[model samples]
Target: MQAFAYVACAHKKTNLTNLLISFKDVSIRHFNTLVFEDLNFSLEKGQHWALVGNSGSGKSTFLDFIMGKASMARGEAYYPYFDQHIQEHHQDDPLFNRYKLITQVSARHEFRNLSNTSDFYYQQRFNSCDSEDADTVSTYLSSIKVVNPSGLWTIQKATEWLKLTYLLDKELIKLSNGETKRLMLAAALIKNPVLLLLDNPLNGLDVSARQDFNELIREISESGISIIMATPATEIPESITHVAVLESGKMIIQCKKYEFKPISFHTIGQIQTNQDELKQLLSATPSVVYDTIIGMEDVSIKYGDKQILDGVNWQVRQGQRWALTGHNGAGKSTLLSLINGDNPQAFANKIILFDQPKGSGESIWEIKKKIGYVSPEFFQYFPTGSTCLQVIESGFDDTLGLFRVSGKSRAETSLRWMTLLHISEFAGALIRNVPVSIQRICMLARAMVKNPSLLILDEPCLGLDVERQEQFKNLIDTICSMTDLSLIYVSHYQEEMPLSITHSLKLEQGRVV
Candidate 1:
């Protein structure tokens, strides 16, 4: 990978008139499942194209093919140097060598050893794995060469351009999602690939980050580099000159961005929860005055020289639902950890969960029994091969897998929740084999199966498409209206918040803002 980046940095300006990338009757497949077939497309030197699609519509697969990381089943896919550059040379002494693909999944977390294997492609997908050895921001930036030959671009200039100076000394893993993306974009720019591919570049980013990224994209386009990006229709920037929409193994529509008006995106049907039963399961006695669900006073967390949370004060009562708002790296995850009793730091802080002070001799399991949690990370690490029913049934014991035998009543409860989530058909299917969207729904069912007093959802809508996000939000609304389930919903997109969120907590740089 470093060799590829180095080659790109060393290449001279190519003829702008030549085709940069071409796909002629190309078909791509993964796990023998066809992604897209009979796709014919061509990218010019300066035109920017948006590959528009919903989740599972093969947007990422499209980009992976361009990166040479994905296999073509039947047709032809060609790159400049690898195809035309070599063919023009009579298949000898190939001159082209660089292709930069900045995917939705970060390449930062993968072991350097897997650099030669295709398995390294999506190693960072759907989860954030912390790396203590990640290089500091400045060091990371300096490693890449500035592609511009006039010595006009420098590491310092790139840092300023991306608004990443604030994280100059922070480890890559320590940066927030927004910060990480800015750095990734900068890395791509430094390599100066003739053809650049971005997969959902705006995802998990705050509004400011998106603005910064769009500006960067414009700058790259103005510099005459070819760009192919994959994003949903709603997020297609005005900079896109052309748009292509993909459906079941085909390009249903391809036209100029200005002329493309996507029909309203509405999924097949919505998932309806059992409101009456949810209400019963969520029933709780009205606390007499001081009963608290979660309380934290002057809670601070620091990892060596880094501060994660600084004197944060917050409280959750019996019936209140809260929207936790913050940019990436705002300590939202840390705060949720305190409530979920998963962090050892909770023992040193004056935090209370379920009316019991943390570290006051309350068993972790006991505290966990009263609070149900779901997060993207939870789904990523969820045990594989466990059937969807087993995943939900295990919620009864607060375990990773179904270890303890569930009673008939518990089994029935799991089945009911699965039905409400519209994943009953997959009840016997392995959770790993289920589609990502369905897997997330099953996780939600697991969180609701035990009917805990408090619900903590940390960006529960992270991977869901628009329709799935709406369905999840509607379920949350139903639970809030019918039950006394206290909720701490965390999300970067304000629009994804449910109507049940009556209160909000904002965090900025590890402090309550």
Candidate 2:
């Protein structure tokens, strides 16, 4: 209910070491297991620290501790503030009057103090009643280009964020997951608090957006702001001068500058099979001569008159990889959804799938056997507790993995694919504990195990490093040569597109304008 209480913002610059955000004997637990305990560390101004480990290794839980969202088993957080007004008013008053404990949360879109009771959080969470404060959140969202200026504050921006995080794009009452995260940031950076904590703010953004956010963090740090961020990958910019590493509630490493040994980035791609034999396997079916596997004919999808997809016309076929580039709110994702049969009614007469008649009971689902997807929104719902091999075996079920996979041959084949992807080392590991890049490989292996006929990759390369991307490209080539798959690559950046893909279908303003 209080602004800046859960997460504080930047104040004036001070010596972070002297400023003092000290915690003593802090511990947190979940059920029987202690998530973290006996942690003590100090964060100062201009210190950047990366918290790296496997998934579910208490990273998100650690962020929760600072936000005051999690219950701590034991510990105390202390900050120092010299208040001249308190000195003059009542020298006998407790020191608590001068110092305030900063909360945990990351700041991005609108660097402002946020209150839970405000309509911004309340109305957005459960959208039946309009929050009196909806105007403020709406105004901020409008300014940041997340929503339109002249619309219902609670309804518009709230639904868009819901959609981005893979919720139903209707009323917020229908939210699916356990609380939605934002494409923007929590509004805590404006509070000017003594301590600042950021969760993993860089997880789902595109590569270009990552660079943009890094720049913003640098600007904040250079102005003498104190920041403590938890991330699996060490992305310490030159701005970060100190670090504190926490593991199992203990300070594993703390230093003025935590130097992670730079492992040499190596490219991993192999062509043990003959290129000629591989070429025959990768060839597309020569029966279809249409330049596009699918085409949109002056398609105009609208919400009333405001067209989400304008009269768009485009062509896409095998061997072509179009990045589907666009700014946020540019209707890129909307178009992809339409193609994937998620919204068939939205554009009935104007669209075609693999040259199939789109409207007459035809959908991308009819050709579902041919497509494979990797949207960030869709990927999160994928079951992750299963082993790398078990889930891969379930791909034969063609149900985004199934609960019961019993065939020994399928499991053996799945392990073979895991070996092919160089993930045999983790064949026994849980998907929930692996890194994003590894999880992606697992998913890719799942998709490729069946050798889908027309692979439709929606932002497939997300979370992959340059090495994996290269490895993936070769894998795609090998698969294409091994079977008949017409690849459809969609992304917002041209650079992320693999050089092997040569076709494109550009969508602007809903139509192919």
Candidate 3:
């Protein structure tokens, strides 16, 4: 339990004088499952590492092991530099090593209210009044207690480096997915740890932000802080010196950055879905045929003095596919919230959904029944206690979690969608227990279970591997071909979009560009 237990003198034969971390013959267990075994990895003082693998390949678990959060069944994980720090400052308190020597910016983040309680819901982000209760970005960043201030990372420097200066006054709960990612990185930098861990750091960022982030990573590496990040193979930054590829709970490949070859993704063929199940689902929830799926006219939304969307005009029609393009904080999410009936400000603007004007007698639930929605923000706040089956079933009623008991038909339909998505094996598994990629697949199945007429996917492929991304993209194309489904897809990577897209909308600073 002490930090010294993991610290040992470097082997004379290895001669790694500047080693920061070394894992030898390591075996890790999560519950009864052996998640990692015979894992050997090392990090030198100047080396930055990238952990690349498919979904559920234990990439995140590897990072957790380095952070001292994993249960090691056998072998030793030595921390030479961190041990020195512990010996110098808190020798008796080994448990504080993780807090003092390491900081991790994960893909998921949670924000609390002003009262410092996490009593918020998924829909609260769309409700302006409720969002105000959450801490502002500036407050959240300032609240971080820097353990080892090196004068290298201040709040000002972190914000400026991450291009987050304009969002300092915004509420934490109201920021987009990419904005939140930047804020989390800034918080970690301010802590000034000896090692930084990032899990899929570029998953939610737009193209420009991703480029900026890669540059920042290079700068950070030069600043003497070691970084070990779990990322897709294609996203490995040039700052990284080494690459480790994991598969099925084993480190399969380890080599220098220049020697690593990227994995090639083949063209995915059409997905074969059960036509009877699709027909039954569509018949059960017959969508009213409408020419205009969504209509917005000079719509403007503001939270206090901050303008989220300014005089934006857009429209979508039946059987049309749209690719929504915008950088972080460019009002893409806000615009989608209006169509999905999540933002309360929709009533104050001139908007239409499925031919019904905003503030009409139609209930939000009625409007939502015809629209399938998924986003990174929704995934972060989704209730995780329900099983995968239950999570998808709830989508039929457009609820966050399963409430009412589903009958035979709904259960069958949910199972059908799960099977099509290759996730039926996890039907009984709790959503929180699944890998992030599987969780995302479950959400996609949930969105498609009802066979809704309109599908709004906001960065739906954030954490998927190359194979899974191709499969999902092909599935989207197949679904569009078979049904009259209208689509509004959003992704920072243009390659992730399906071939069915027929229109594009670009937003810059809340205005159509």
Candidate 4:
């Protein structure tokens, strides 16, 4: 196991009166792994910090240390501010002390149904009947017990700040990836904690939402709430006063925000793909060539009185790569569901997929077999019990998890995809035990293992670092160059789009703009 360290920079003149937390020669371990050693850090009351590192570099683990979740092996972690606050106000109430000081909004959230049970699958989001079992955004938010409401963040204020006012009545499972991110932020703010921890907070957000969130973070910091956020170096917000860099579970450098320079540990070299393996995978599932991969005429999707997609007209021809751009709740997911045959409403609409008309004799599995797909929702709800190899193998059958024993050839192909994605080491690891970024890479491998004719990547790079994002983009370009694969790529950042995208479609309020 690799050891990790964190480098924190602070001014020489430290005021004890304003000191929030301090760690002295802190050694920590998680399970049997030594994550950090001799970690010395301090956070003042007014400073906001950003932890910048690659995947599995202990950024999230460091956040856990601050939340008193890490198993400390040596030294002392003193929380002066928290201690004083608790002693001054609620010394007798242990529960209040445990719940009032800090809150964390992780990169991945586990949402429950209205029955308060997590008995749901990945496809439940697309099924209208199953989706209704989830609590509404309003209900979810209202159910959180506020430990200490300082009049800083009310439910209304938090929703308005996160731009979640329109999604109050929407079911939690039905919200878009970006929408769910906002709801999570809102729920955190409602707790009114003195210290807030955000792990990759801007990952799933759209461009506008990210900008709004940065400003909101600034507001929250100004209102006396200190924040420690884990994010990419390029995404460190203006609100952050200091920055800490961690690599290989060790802190290499720390400096003021203005003094910090972003570092790229992984070089963007040419990715060498095994031509014979690629040929074998591509030829394994030969697809029928069609002039129009997808054709939609006056397509409209409605649920009850609300309109999701309104008279949308779009066409995707074979081998054409498309960039699908839209803000949060702009119906981008809904549009993709129609093409992927997940939504039953497609039967009522004049939609054509893979040269076949809707309501044809073709089954949904047949349609899914020809189209490789990956999205944030899929990653969030994916079964974590299976090993990464099993998850990748499941792609061949277009199922959520591996249902039957995979053949030797299928397992070999899956390992090849995992190796190509640089996640071969985790092939034997269960999805639940790895970091979120590793799990995301596994999902990407699953989408490509089948070598389908059409590929739909919905914010595929959501939780990846700068290095992984570049690598995946390069892989996408390489695959398109080698095969006749059509692509419908959705991303908020223009730079994140693959160079293969030659056409674009933008949506606003469910209408093509």
Residue 39 in model 3: lDDT: 84
List residue ranges in candidate 1 displaced over 4 A: 1-17, 80-134, 139-154, 262-290, 377-416, 424-436
Report every candidate's CA lDDT.
Answer: 0.70, 0.53, 0.84, 0.83
Candidate 3 ranges beyond 4 A from true positions? 1-15, 92-95, 263-287
lDDT of 2 at 82: 27
TM-score for candidate 1, please give it: 0.79
Cα lDDT tens digits, model 1, 205-239, are 77677777777777777766667887767778777
Q: Per-residue lDDT tens digits of candidate 2, residues 445-511?
A: 7766655655667666655655566677777766654554577776654665666576556654454
Tens-place lDDT per residue, model 4, 1-513, is 333333344554456998888888888786456888888788889989999877788898888777766789888878888889889878888677643678898867878887876655766767789889988899899998786766488999999888888889988888888898888889988988889999999877888888787789888998788899998887888989888887766766767887776543233444455666666666777666888899999999887777999999999999999999999999999999998888888898998888888888999999998888999887776777899999999998988889998889989989987776667998888886677778877887788887788999999887777667777888788788888899999999888999889999999999999
How does model 4 fare in lDDT? 0.83
Residue range with the least summed lDDT across 10 consecutive positions in model 2: 1-10
lDDT of 3 by residue, 1-513 (tens): 101011112222233788787889999986456798888877777888898877898988777767666689999888887777788877877577644678898877866788876666777888877777898899999999886776488999999999989889888888889999999999999988788999999988888888887899998888778899998777888899877777779977677777776643122343456666656555666666898889999999988787889999988999999999999989999898888888888999999889889898989899898888989888887887899999999998999899998878888889988886778999998987778889998998899887788999999998888777887888888778777899999999999999999999999999999
TM-score of each predicted structure versus truth: 0.79, 0.62, 0.93, 0.93
| Candidate 2 stretches greater than 4 Å from native | 1-42, 50-184, 187-215, 218-225, 230-239, 242-292, 362-365, 384-386, 397-401, 481-484, 492-495, 508-513
What range of 10 consecutive residues in model 1 has the weakest lDDT sum?
1-10
Per-residue lDDT value at 366 in model 4: 91
* lDDT, residue 431, model 3: 89
Output the lDDT of residue 209, model 2.
Answer: 52
